[model samples]
Target: MTNTTQTGFALDEADRETFRRQGFLTFKVLEEEEMTRAWRTERLALMDRSNAVYTEEWAVSGNTNISNYDRHLDNDFLADLITDRRITDRVASVLGPDVLCWRTEFFPKYPGDEGTDWHQADTFANASGKPQILWPQNSDFGGTLTVWTAFTEATVDNGCLQFIPGSYTSMNYDETKVMEYRPDGINRNRKEGGVRRGFFGYDYRELQIDPDFVPDESQAVPIVLRPGEAVMFWSTLMHASYPHSGKTEDMRLGFAGRYVPTSVHVYPDTDVVEEYGGKVSLDRYGAVVVSGENRYDHNRIATRTTTGHPFRAH
Candidate 1:
């Protein structure tokens, strides 16, 4: 890991502590003008084609199928944003400089696409048969730092993200049962409270409402970000997005990067691999290292290793 003193966006001790507890953090106005210029140039080239994918609602506005320097196609900008000196330094401050950008995803909420269900962060990783995240240690290493950068203004009308502020510490819901909430209901299981927050392909409607689920709506502020503003949060935090209520021409566009320590193991099961199809794996579903605080090659997958203890319990 390179010394971050020159990276203009180093994180202080307090910032690192916040990330350790919160599971996520964000750095605003860190991208340089030259970087942003290259991003716009490439995107415009992609848009020149008459059949650009952005025409759809709820899809990544510009390019849907980008080449995989990493899964989700680490476009020049995406890669820069993930390993961004600002972001990486902050990550290193908490998880140590020996870090890697594990995953990056572009979440584009179209004008008509329904918002995803309320859920925690661990379930999002597709790391084989075991749960996406291995708790305790998984929760440690500062959990996973998700950098949410806005490509367009994300207002309440355009489906901004909502979260249960202090919910990161809760025991994440069971993945097997959560899968039952998918649209197909393939993995549904009995829940003690009957509040089945959807997963896999499940829909939110199937969830049994937690009558005591009195979410602090007041604390759940709607994040209205400018084209370049962003927020980061812990993976375990309970969060959801609102549906788009903006004009037909408007849609919400943002990008996210998930980072994990290098010591985690990954699962190599094909079936599980299919579940997290778009992800870049170190081995099968083995852990992936995506971004770090230095000039590293893009989409560099580590050779499989049985280093860390496997995290199980689906």
Candidate 2:
């Protein structure tokens, strides 16, 4: 595992203790024409959300459930793939050298959709109830370090990302427990083992502090990416996915990119993020250091990229 590689890609020494006891990590950062030119400039920047930093929420006025969260502060190939250094130098080698790529979303399952539920997120507050990230009152635990990536070929029939390995220090769903946004309960519940997950319409087992727990899917796994591949996990980890199975007509499309460690607190007293039912307004949000130097001025950073692209830190 101490098999190394450098000049911009990292993690060796037994893959950094196997990513500090398996929070997660996959490879191949991007190729295949940089995932077909970042999915053709993210489908022409999602049909012009007019410089989107998340204007309309559930994406298309159609509701495939909704996520265009930060769009890397208005896309410059997702702001240089969210400060790429093979993902901010392997998440600044597990969060240290001043990292900070505060959010960037866009999941998109499609075809028959539904899958993403298991959930974990340390203070993402499950989904915007508050505390989008705090970490460091002497730090016992903090989460964000996502990265996701595969904007196209994921495949376990179309959904992909599953995880569970070491279960990242276990929180078992309870980001201060909230969960209840039912945009008509998205693909209609369906999970007493029939599978077809759901979180976009919120049912992450209803904030499961333990309402009959359950998620030992034989220690899950399936991450299968290909078009530009990428993984890096631990948004608290346990994760979930796998329901697309419309037998394929191309849809998977992940693209996360969270990160943290500029001494945390990206959205402390948040300004309007709500959740799947839709809301959004951290009012021109910022946070994009991406590697070092941001020695704590609390938050709101953003150096260059409302469309200019100079996030360059790593």
Candidate 3:
């Protein structure tokens, strides 16, 4: 494994080759004890979202997916986590030197919760009907690099992430297609393999380019992780999760920080994010540059958290 003085865990050429072939990589980014302590405090503190960047009345619709969107913009701990060198350095190794963290979200699966539907995100327009991120016309890639950290121990019984290796090269679903968000539809659908799954409230199958195309579950691999461990993968990879079997009372939580090159335009032609039965204004939204300098002037950049904590880039 090759390591750089600046980036202690930078991916070696072989590592990059593996990621290119498999479309995902797993690594340890945070200490278990530190993450446990920090999450214990931060989870309670996050309850008071009085200073959150997305504070519109509709943004707080209870239990909606939008409720936990972009907390890194206000929470100091999350801000530091997103810009952590361990993550950004590896992300930069794959996506190039200049990288921006455009989004962060909390994925919590309580006992008895359904698994996320098998899906791939390119432009991220499946449910919102608007392209959330737009790559340059000549670019070869189309999706963000999502670094998903397990804030809580993730087991197959508790909805651990599942992925189809080497499934990132081509998109099976069309992002341009619209998916109806029916809040009442949660936990109601089972796919071909009888895996109880749904994408929040929307059925990801609605966006499938070939409605008859069912994901090959035989090739799916479950990723069980200890708390503080993380896996970074292309957003276009075929990924899902196992349903929480109600075997454990503790909820499984995954924190995802999404990164893209500076050349990409985040939230292109929009000031609001509408999805999952709620809408939020982007008035206070800005992409945080986590590595290298951003030479593009297209996206709004945030140098500090809403609470005045500066983001320290690698």
How accurate locally, in lDDT, is each candidate?
Answer: 0.50, 0.76, 0.88
Q: Write the per-residue lDDT of candidate 3 for residues 20-86, one digit (tens) a residue.
A: 9999999988899989998999999899787787776564565478878888877888988998988
Lowest lDDT block of 10, candidate 2: 305-314
The reply for model 2, stretches above 4 Å from the true place, is 1-9, 16-49, 53-70, 73-81, 86-116, 119-163, 166-182, 186-197, 202-214, 217-231, 234-255, 258-314
Off by over 4 Å in 3: 1-7, 59-63, 189-191, 305-314
What lDDT tens digits, residue by residue, belong to model 2 across residues 1-314?
A: 32335535667767778777888978876886868876876787666666655566445344443456776676677787887777787778878788888877788888887788888888887766778788989997888889888878887888888888788887877777777777676777577467788877777788888789888888787989888878898888888888787886777888888888888887776666766666666666677887888878778787773434334222
Residues 103-199, model 1: lDDT tens digits: 5666777775555456654544322224443323534333465767787778777777777666787644444443331333322432222222223
Sorted by lDDT (best first), the order is: 3, 2, 1
Clashes of each: 21, 1, 0
Q: Which candidate leads the pack in TM-score?
A: 3
Count clashing residue pairs in model 3. 0
Clashes of 1: 21
